[model samples]
Target: MAPVNEAARPALKAGTRDAHERRIDRAVALIERAIAQGEEPPELGRLAEAAAFSPFHFHRVYRAMTGETTGQTVARLRLLQGLRLLASERRSVTDAALAVGYQTPQAFTRALRQSLGTAPSELRAEPERLWREIDRLAQPPQPEQGEDAPPLRVEVVSIDPFQVVALRVEGGYEAKHAGYERLFGWAGAHGLLDRLQGLYGVAVDDRRDVAEPQCRFDCMLALGEGVDPTGLPGLRLTRLGGGRYARIRHVGAFDGLEAATDALLARWLPASGERLGDALLYHDYLDDPDQVPQALLRTDVYLPLQC
Candidate 1:
């Protein structure tokens, strides 16, 4: 699924942004709940009401925040539900298709091809492989604001909620150095750079589905409550709720981050008997590319986990 190309929205005030995000979470939860019911799910108007937005506004707001249209999320959820049913062998293909709101097995198979890159029967026959190819499509590592673990070594740890002064950017990962420089300049000018304890990155959208030009990320520096930039231009302060997280280090370039994330999600997660946590994955920058070689640059990928 291609990322929707939407115009930039005005910057959000901290309180308003928090409320908006929470509402989005609520709206998504409702959608997921309906998907789990294995029924047609709720109507868009009802979903909007639950999210406290008009149907028209809700559609736009949802895409703005999550980098996906409401229809895409709903479709992905239904497809995943169908895939799970097939994997568990709990339902025949046709039954699974109907449960996910497909009117016919043919329609279901066609959707599976479009989204998962494989037919329903193919996915059922090779669940793990199919899962590897399509997992990011469902929920790529996301940002809930947290950072560094050891390379390839998986560790489980708890994170206390923290705050950061962040600027959202769009474009290539390395091209984001300009964005980082702007952030550093702001912090330096305010005398906050030296006091900063950690530098972090939030993968706001998955590149697999988002065009490079449209990818959104947050360049953040750890800022305590005492250092508020309430009215700072191009900067916002947000809190990422903390919990248990599965942390792993990705050595080498950011380009390979996807495979590293996949290792954790597709390989390590199921074997650990742990479930994916609600928060998005965060990157803790360990070395500066300007100072160190790209091959040696390191980042810690943190995957929030259900404890």
Candidate 2:
């Protein structure tokens, strides 16, 4: 199945509803502005006024159109910027916490742990540890597979909760691949594995599903809390956008990922429109393939479709 073209959606009259589009545009712009300043966002009521939406209807419509509560989206944006600072800065954890707008270090730590699953200190100690792991995997061995392998037994479902570290990129196909490899190497060299839940390839652009002319992708790593970005070089962290997705748990290899993706978008999507909502086509690995291949592999491929 051909990938859905997000640009094409703009041409569809039903997708261009005046009220919904304004809400989404306002919400997105608000976030972009907040991230740039590295701070907490303003009240939803004020945002609603700016978007020309009544406060009572703004929250519901915003969530309906964007597939996220306004608070969740804003909180995530602030935290991603905060995590980057924490990982790359040399300042004390308390300083990093305050830099991102937390009233206190303890409050920041509590939020960090809930979101990323690690305390602040362990994340700070990953530099040396990551480097060692990268050195170990410098030369990866080939995998051997049986010719008659059964269709990799897998279950396709919907996933709405997951987080990832994503860097937006614009470039050639080869450059994208190389970028991800470098990111993987960086993650390993920094002992990021200990702090990360897993590694992921997150698509942040509307053009990704399109062909060569427009496709773009975000190379990402999924880390728990405490993975500071204070001292890391040339990296930015962005959370995976949360939403409804058609999910699949595939085993064996990542090579045939497209085929599974097709099944959801082409085969299942049309039938499941009633339960679907506005969301992106999302994909996330259940575990790291580097650590174990043919080792009970699990991956969730999320394709946002109308419910």
Candidate 3:
């Protein structure tokens, strides 16, 4: 999905409605602003105070809402800032460390190596190699199909047609989080969060056939009845036609979807005598990543099948 335009966001009303989302937004904004300003990491108590939450309950609330603890957020932002200073500003390791709130170059190098699998000096010396490593790390582990491993099970089922509000994005699938975040914020503002029925990811291009930078993805939220998106500017409504689909349950990180899909197409289809249908393949996300552990994230990959 494309990065959301800040101006396109709906104006939120002041009330008790969506109070949790508002607080989360405020906390996230505070953390981001502090990071961008090169200030020391905000204390947990300070962040909680800014979000109008008690420090005692703030950590659990932040983790439930954002999928990471407050300390993790701080560390991640600082690490990203350090990387930017090293890559874009061409700063030395020592300078980048201090600039990003690390006490010493050694500490910065240790964190960098832990996060990116490369030392700061190595990143400066061989940027391309670092990218290759990062890409390797991004790939999901391929499932082992040995005799001891269970076979990949696929169930063919008929699904009814559905209406969705989709945000089209052109780029790597890893970037879809921004689109989903925007959708969540919009839904919260409109008091439509409870009305959401499902979340779907439509893959417009096969990553194996298209370059990562040119791939297309759509982040879709399935709208329940009576939740009309009509007259809503910047909202694109799409109807997914009803059809027979081969569904494969994928259990793990989002990165594993591609590999699971590959397994379905390469191993299952030819053996099952199933022919492909005209409609695009998509994923039905069953668990919210923000609230679930990565190892337990569940998604159902649906491939349109010939009737």
Per lDDT, the best of the predicted structures is: 1
Clash pairs (backbone) in predicted model 1: 142-280
Ranking by TM-score: 1, 3, 2
- lDDT for each of the candidates? 0.70, 0.55, 0.69
1-307, model 3: which lDDT tens digit per residue?
A: 2111112113244443356547766886787787777677677788888877666445534554454556667777777767767775457889888886888999999998787777888787887765554454333233333224457777777777787888877777456887787777778888889888889988775554467888778898986655555444456878664777778889999877766775665455544555556676788899989899999999988877666
Q: What C-alpha lDDT, on a 0 to 100 scale, does residue 206 get in candidate 2?
A: 31
Question: Candidate 2 regions off by >4 Å?
Answer: 1-162, 169-177, 188-191, 204-214, 230-234, 241-243, 251-255, 273-275, 286-298, 305-307
lDDT of 1 by residue, 84-192 (tens): 7777676898988887788898988999888767787777788687676456556823432112433346777777778877888898866578778888888888888
Candidate 3, backbone clash total: 2
Q: Rank the candidates by lDDT, best first.
A: 1, 3, 2
For candidate 3, the 10 contiguous residues with the lowest summed lDDT are 1-10
TM-score of each: 0.53, 0.39, 0.49
Residue 202 lDDT, candidate 3, scale 0-100: 85
In the range 1-307, model 2's lDDT, one tens digit per residue, is: 1122221122223433444456557766776586657566768777887766555445544544444556666656555555566667576878777876777889777876786666667766785632343343222222122224333332333344455666545654465667667776777788875665655675443332345545566667777544555444557755554543445666656655555554443233323322334454556666655587754777766554342
Give the better candidate number (1 or 3) by TM-score: 1
